[model samples]
Structure formats: C-alpha cells, structure tokens
Target: MALMTIPLIIFLFPLAYSPGPGNMFFAANGARFGFKSTLKANIGYHIATFIVTYLLGIGFGVGVSYSPTLMLIIRYVGVLYVVYIAWGLIRAGITKRNQSAKHASFIDGVVLLVLNPKAYIIIALMFSQFQPSTIDPQFYFIIGWISAVFTLNNMIAFFFWTVLGDKIVGLFRDKTKAHILNFILGSMLLVVAAWMAYN
Candidate 1:
C-alpha cells in the first residue's frame, strides 16, 4: 500500500488538475464570490465525491453502471444542470453589480456530483485500475484509502482553481474587464456542457 502512494498520486494529479466541469464550477464561483464564500460548496462536493467513489470502489456502483437507461438519464440531467449554471453566470456578467450574483450552495455541489456522468466514469476507471482483484481483510481499508486520496487530490485541485479565479478577478479593477471574464468563464462552461452531452 505504501508503494502505491506515488503511483496513485501520479495517476490522479492530471485528472484532478485538468479543467473539467468541477474545476470550472469552482473557478466561476470563486471569481464571483471569493474563496471563503465557496467553502461550503467545496466541502459539499468532496463529501459527495468521497462517498460515491468509495461506494463504486466497493462494487456498489456496479449495478448503476450496468444500467444504460439510468446512465442516460443522469447524463441529460447533468447537462441541463450545467446549462442552468452557465446561464446564471452569463446573466451575472451582464449586470454591473456582480454582488447580486448568488454564491453556489452546498446542495448545488452535491447535485453537481450526483448528476455528473463524467465523475462516475472516472471513478469506475480508477477502481478498475487500482482495486485489488482478490478480496481480503484490508480490501475495504484499501478502498477507503484510495477514495480519501482521490477526494483530497480533488480538493487541492479545486482550491487551486478557486484561488486562480479570485486572483484573476483581483487583477482587474475595472468592472468591464470583470464582466468580460465572467462571460468567458460562462461560455467555457456552456462548451463543457455540450461536450458532456455529446460524449
């Protein structure tokens, strides 16, 4: 288990750090609301992430994974949810006072993970690659460890993205520049939604 630590980190680093729905969501929220305001959402996201990933690792998610109909429903729902968030960001960008924009809530984070198809796929892939073939006394322990690590990695990545967003917004004192940045972030989210739907 000790030897696997470095490999696990290596495998998860790129996946966690790379821009995706989760990263973008945090980034946009961080830009609009600042890092401290986004803490609840971050906590909610990781809590859901750890639970879901652990369940998947233990074979609980296997049943859901096999159901194409359920998967399709989740995919479409996630796409729609993302679109909704994107619309909010775009709408906020049009307004002169960004303070009117509402920060993402804890429920929003949980729902994001619950509906996200990509999250399921990634967890499935991670378990397939890392889970031991033979069950043992330590099997559950190992799964829990992996799940914790994955959650931690994601937390760090999201924090970085959130800080990056805050920093970017901090650089621009002009409202126009801030609005443009919001527009771009919102557009990027829309593109991510499209990609999710298509893929």
Candidate 2:
C-alpha cells in the first residue's frame, strides 16, 4: 500500500491535467460563463467523479472493465455526446454569441461525467494498477486513500483548466480571436472524442 503512491501520482497527474473531454468541457464552460458562475457545474462534476472513483476502487467496477460489449456501447454514446458538445462550442464561437444564457447547468455536468467513457476507463485503470483485493487486510483502507487522492488530484486539474479558460476569455477580447479560440477548444474536444472512439 505504501509503495503505490508514486505510481498512482505518475499515472493520474498527466491524464487529469491533459486536455481530455472532462477538462475541456469545464474549461469551455468557464470561458463562456465566468469561473465563479461555473462553480455549480464544477461541484457537480467532481462529486460524480469522486463517487465513481470510490465505487471503482471498492471493487464495484468489475462489470465495466470486463464487458467488451458494454464498453463498445459506452464508447459510441460518449463519442456522440462529445461531438454534440463540440458542435455547441463551435456554434457559439462562429456566431459570436455569448452563450451564458444557454450554458450547461449542474445537472448537465453530472450527466456528462457519468456518461463519459474516459472517466470509467481512468477509474478502472487506476483500480487495476493498484490491485485492490478483498483478500488483502488493508483493502478498504487503501481504496479509501486512493479514491481520496485521486479525487483531490482531479479537483486541482479541473480548477486549473477552469481558471485558464477564464483568463483566456479576457485575453481574447477581439471577436475574431475569441472565435478562433472557441474553434480551437471545440477542435480539442473533437480530438478527445476521436481518441475515445479508437482507444
């Protein structure tokens, strides 16, 4: 249990920090609506993330990781959802419309993370690498610790991206630059969606 810390951080930090679907979604929302306004979504997203990670760590994720058919279905659904989000971003950008009125709500964020295949994959991988076994005397303790750490790491990652996007909005005061930034963010979402489909 003591030996797992370094490996866990090494494995999770990059994935959490990288421009994945979840991070990008939050960042995009932060840009559209200020970070303060997006806190509701952030809270919802991280709560779901924490709960899902806890379940996965405690041996409840077996069905997800082993079922290839379920994973395939999830992948396609996730791809479609991500594409839909990308389209929204692109539309908002192209129209130069401040979409604060129609931005994602707390429930939307919860649903997005719950359906995201990448979130499940990341949790499953974290559990697998940690090898949480019932036979181990410290199973529950270890799982709790790991879940807490993972959730904390994710919280930091989410905050960083959200703030970065919030700052970016100020920088891109020009309509054309703002439009270009939105397009780039939308493209990043599409790329992540593609990765989800193939990987």
Candidate 3:
C-alpha cells in the first residue's frame, strides 16, 4: 500500500489536469468571465467532485452502474447536457461577447461535475487500484481521507486551467483576437461534447 502512493499521485495528477470536460468547462468560464468571477463556481465544482468521489469510494457507485436501465438513462441525460452546454457556449461567443453574461453559474458547476461520466470512471479506477482482496475495517476511513487529498489536487488543476484560459484571453485583448479565442474555446467545447457522445 505504501508503494502505491507514488504511483497513485503520478496517475491522478495528469488525469486531473488533462483537458477533459471539467477542465474545458472551467477554461471556458475563465475565458468568458475571468478567474475572480469563476472562483465560487470552482469551489462548487470541487465540492461536487469530492462528494461524488466519496460516494463511489464507499460503495454506492457499483450499484448505480450495475443497473443497465439506470445507466442508460444517465448516459443519455449526460450526453444531452453536454450538447446543451456546447450550444450555449457557442451562442454566447457569437452573440453575447460584448455583454457580461453569466456563462457558467455556481449550480452549473456542481451539476456538471455530478453528471460528468469521466469523473466517475476516474474515481472508480483510482479506488480499484487501492482496494485489497478483503475488506478492512479502516477502509472507508482511508478512502475518505484519500478522496479529500484527491479533491485538493483536483481543485488545483482546475485553477491552473482556468488561469491559463484567463491569461490567454488577456494576451489577446483586441476585439477580433478575443472573438477568435472565444471561437476556439467554443469549438473545444463542441469537440468535447462529441467525444462524450461517441464514447
């Protein structure tokens, strides 16, 4: 178990930092609204991530995925949500670039994390690597503790992605360049949505 720590950190860091739906979502928000405005949503996202990770680590995750009917429903709902978000991002970029509209609300952050399929798979794989053949009395405690650590890392990754997007926009302050940035971000969102639907 002790030897697993290093490998786990290495595995998780890249996975958390990678450009997935969550990272892209934050990046888009920061590009649209700046880091200061996105902080609360970031907090909400991490809170949701922690809760979902904890739930999966403890046991409920298995039951939820075991039912094919329920899993199918979740899959379709998630796909629709991704599409909706992609559409909204594109619309915002094209029509509301000059306005200070809220691109992603706090509740939106929470809901996105909860519904994100990649998040669940990552949490599941993380625990699977650590679980022993037999249940130990201290298992849940360890799981909770490790999940807190993972959540912290997750939050940090989100901050970097958000800041990166914010700074990128700051560099291109001209209207045309800013619009180009928005188009790129919106395009990335569309690609993510398509990827989610395909996978």
Candidate 4:
C-alpha cells in the first residue's frame, strides 16, 4: 500500500498541482465560469489521461521527445491562449454587472486538455517511470484507486481557484470596474505569455 501510494502521488502531483497549460486553463475557467463550468475541464483532463495513459503508458514520452517541432508548436499555442484567457478573466473579475458567471464551456475545457503541453509531457513521463505488470493485481487496483484520487483532487483544486475567481470578479460591479480588472489581468497575461514563449 505504501509503495502504491508513492506512485499514485507522483501521477497526482503533476496533474493536480502543476503549472502547465491545463492548470492555467482551469484556473481561468474557474475565474470566468463557476466551478460547475469547471467540471467538464476537470473531467476532460483525466479522460485525456485515460486515452494516453493506457495506450503507450511510459513509452509515449520517448516518442514525443523525438519530435521537438511538435513540442514547439504546442508551447507557442499555449502561450497565446493563456494571453487570451487572461483578458477574459480580468474582464469577468472587474465587471460590476450582476450577470451570469464567467466560465468557458465544456468544449473549452476539452480544448484546454488537448492544448495543454505540460500535461502531456508530465503524464507521459510519469507513465514512462511507472508500469502496471500483467501478473500484478496491485497495478490494476492502483488504477481504480488513482482514478478516484484524480477526480477528487481536481474537483477540490478547480473549485478553490474558480471560487476565488468568482469572488474577485464580484468585486467590480460595473462595466468600468470590469475594464479595470481586464487591463490588469491582460497585462499579467502578457508577461506570462512572454515568459512561456521565451522559456
């Protein structure tokens, strides 16, 4: 059980807490859309893992690394999207209107999972590092257990950020206040984008 916990934690750590495109996307979703909107994103993330994880498992990373160009494209796309999301987040936060929440849709969440380069690389690496043996019932058991962990962890983490976004956005009650928030978030996004692009 202890050994099982360590491997599970390794998988959980990168997915649940890393600062990749998925994290930024979910964080932005939380800020714009209520946690409910974030639900799809959280689900999409694991669905993606379900596809990639069970396929090549640990071997995917080696193949991905060979194609540096693909990584480059994904990295740049992530940077650009992050900037766009930052604008929306700022806008939602500053708007004084008592309008509906500011979350992206399920499709948005799906795309985020698709676009998130960090998630792919990290999960690929983790899969590569760990393996489920044919004879090992423990391996399959761990999968069921890990699935539960990822679900709960994402729900909690996504809610925390989304709630924070909702509250922050609530502060500005009008168009003027919204514009202010927009500017700040947009500017922050610009800086982050530059860092992503450069890095």
Candidate 5:
C-alpha cells in the first residue's frame, strides 16, 4: 500500500491540479468572497467527492448501468449550472460594487458535484486503474484508502487554486483591476462549461 502512494499521486496530479470546473469554481468564489468565506463550499465538495467515489468504488456501476440516460442528463444540467454561475460573476464584474454577490453555499457545492459528469468519469477511471480484479478481504480497505486519497488530493488542489485567486486579487489594490480579474475568471468558467457540454 505504501508503494502505491507515489504512483497514485502522480496519476492524479494533472487531473486534480488542472484548471477544471471544480478548481475554477473555487477560484472564482475565492476571488469574489475570500478563502474563509469559501470554506463551507470547499468542505461540501470534498465530502461529496469522497462519498460518491467510495460508492462507485464499491459497485455503484451497476446502478449507473441501469440508468442509461442518467449521465447524459447530468452532463447537460452541469453545463447549465456552470453557465449560470459564470453569468453571475460576469454581472458582478460589470458593477462597481457587487452588493448582491454572495459566496457559494454548501448546497451549491453538493449540487455541483451531483451534476458534474466529469467528476464521475474521473472516479470511474481511478477505480479502473487502481482497483483489484478479484474481490478479497482487503478490497473494501483498498477502496476506502483510494477514496480518501482522491478526496485529499482534490482538497489540496482546490485550496491552492482558491488561495491563488485570493492572492492574485490581493496583489491589485485597484477595484478596476479586481473587476478585470473577475471577468477573466468568469470567462474561463464559460469556456469550461462549453467544454463540458461538447465533450
């Protein structure tokens, strides 16, 4: 198990650290509402990630197979959700003071995970690569360990992106520059949404 740690980290690094929807969502929220304010959403997301990944590791694929169109529905819904969040940020950027802007909630984080097809795909891929072919006494233990590691890796990546967003905005003392940052982040989210929809 110890020997698997390095390889697991290496396999997950790009997937977790890349500017995907989850990382971008946290970064945008962090830029708009600071790291402390985004903590609830952070916790919610990782919690869901761990739960969903563990379930999938332990034979949730049968359920998914029974619902053939479920993933398709999730993909489109996720696209719309991302677009909605991006529009909010874009609108906020247009205003001098976004008095109406609120930090993402715990529910929002859970919904995002529920709708995100990419997340499910990643979890499936992780199990495919790491899970043993035959079930044994250690199967449950291995699955739990993988799920925990996957959640921890994602948590760290999201935290880094969140802090990066906060620090980037902090570097600019001017409000206009801050607004520009919001626009950039929001636009990047739109791109991610498009990618999710088409791919």
Candidate 6:
C-alpha cells in the first residue's frame, strides 16, 4: 500500500496540473471573471472531478472503457464540442478580441466534466496502476482516500492559476489580452476534446 503512494503521487500530480477541460475552463473563466466569482465554478469543477474519480475507482469506469456504444457517444459529443469551442476561439480571436465575454459559465463547466472522457480515463488509468491484491484487500479503501488527496491537489493547482489570472488581468485591466488568452484556452480545450474523441 505504501509502495503505491509514490507512483500515484508522481503520475497523478502532473496529470492534474496539466491543462484539461477543467483547467482550461478555469483559465478561461478566471481570465473573464475574477477569482472571487470563479470559486463557485471551482467548487463545481472539483466536485465533478471527484464524482468521476469515485465512479471510476469503484469499477464503473470499465463501462466507458469497454462499451462501444458508450464510447461512440462520448466520441461524437466530444468532437462536436471541440469543433464548437474551436470555432468560438477563432471568432473571438478575429472579431471580438477586445470583449470580455462570459464564454464558460458554471453550467458549461459542469457539462464539460460529463462530456470529458479524460476525467474517466484518468481515473481508470490511475486505479489500474495501484495493486489491490492485499490479503484483506483494503487497498481499495486506500485508493479512495488517495483519490480525495488528488482532488485536493487539483483544487490548489486550479486556485493558483485563478489567483495568477486575477493578478494578471487586474494589473493590466486590458480586455484584449484576456480575450486572446481565453481564445487560446478555448483552443486547448478543443484539442483536449479532440484527443479524447480520438482515443
């Protein structure tokens, strides 16, 4: 059990920190709105992540992993979302480069978690890496606790960006830079969604 800790920390931390739908949305929202207003979205996002992880940790993840029908649904939805977001980013970049439009709202963040295959995938991958063959098999419980820890790390990681975003936009008071940043962030979400679709 203790041996699994190091591997879990190393792998999960990087994966959590790296930009995904949640982080991208965090950046987009944080840039558009201040960190104070973004806390609600942050809580919502973490809750979604935890729910996804909890489901996957408890073996529900295999459904998405093996079911072709389910996988296809995820694929099409993800691709369509990616295309939509990509189009938004390009348009914002070209036309509304100076406007601070509220692109990703709270509902948008929650829906992204549902549509995000990466959330489930990460849970499945990390859960697979930990061995649960103890004599009493209590390792499963350990995994659950560790999953919470990962969730905490995610909160801090996102909070950091949200705070930094606050400073950046506050110092500049420039909508152009924020719009451009959001466009790039939206593009990143599109890439993530596309990658999830392809996978």
Q: Which of the numbered candidates is closest to the native, going by highest lDDT?
A: 1
- 73-189 per-residue lDDT for model 1 (tens digits): 998999999999888887664333255667778988899889888888788878878998889999999999999999999999999999998777776557677678878889989
For residues 1-199, could you state the per-residue lDDT of candidate 4 as single tens digits? 5676676676676566644455555555554444566676667666665555444443444555447798788778877787777766655544433346544666676666566565566555555555565536566665555545544565565666556666776665577876775675566666667767886
Prediction 3 TM-score vs. true = 0.87
What is the lDDT for 126 in model 3?
85
Model 2, range 1-199, lDDT digits (tens) per residue? 5578878989999989988888998888778676877787777887888878887777687777679998898888989999999987876643223554676678877888877888888888788778565647787778878888888888899889989888878777677887887788888899989998999
lDDT of 5 by residue, 96-186 (tens): 2244667788988888888877888788788879986789999999899999999999999999999987777676447677667778888
How much RMSD separates candidate 4 from the native structure? 3.9
Winner on lDDT between 1 and 6 is 1
Q: What is the lDDT of every predicted structure here?
A: 0.86, 0.81, 0.77, 0.60, 0.83, 0.68
Query: Which clashing pairs does model 6 show?
Result: none
> What value of lDDT does candidate 3 attain over all alpha carbons?
0.77
Ranking by TM-score: 1, 5, 2, 3, 6, 4
Q: Which regions of candidate 6 deviate over 4 angstroms?
A: 1-3, 82-106, 134-140, 175-179
For candidate 2, the TM-score is: 0.88
Give the winner by TM-score.
1
Candidate 3 local lDDT, 1-199, one digit each (tens): 4575667788799889988888998898787777887887888888988888888787877876467676666666776787776677666533233446765667888988877777877887888886545669978777777788789888999999999887777665776776677778878877877777677
Off by over 4 Å in 1: 94-100
The lDDT ranking, best first, is 1, 5, 2, 3, 6, 4
Which segments of model 4 are wrong by more than 4 Å?
10-15, 56-62, 87-103, 132-152
Clashing pairs counted in every model: 0, 0, 0, 13, 0, 0
Pairs of colliding residues, candidate 1: none
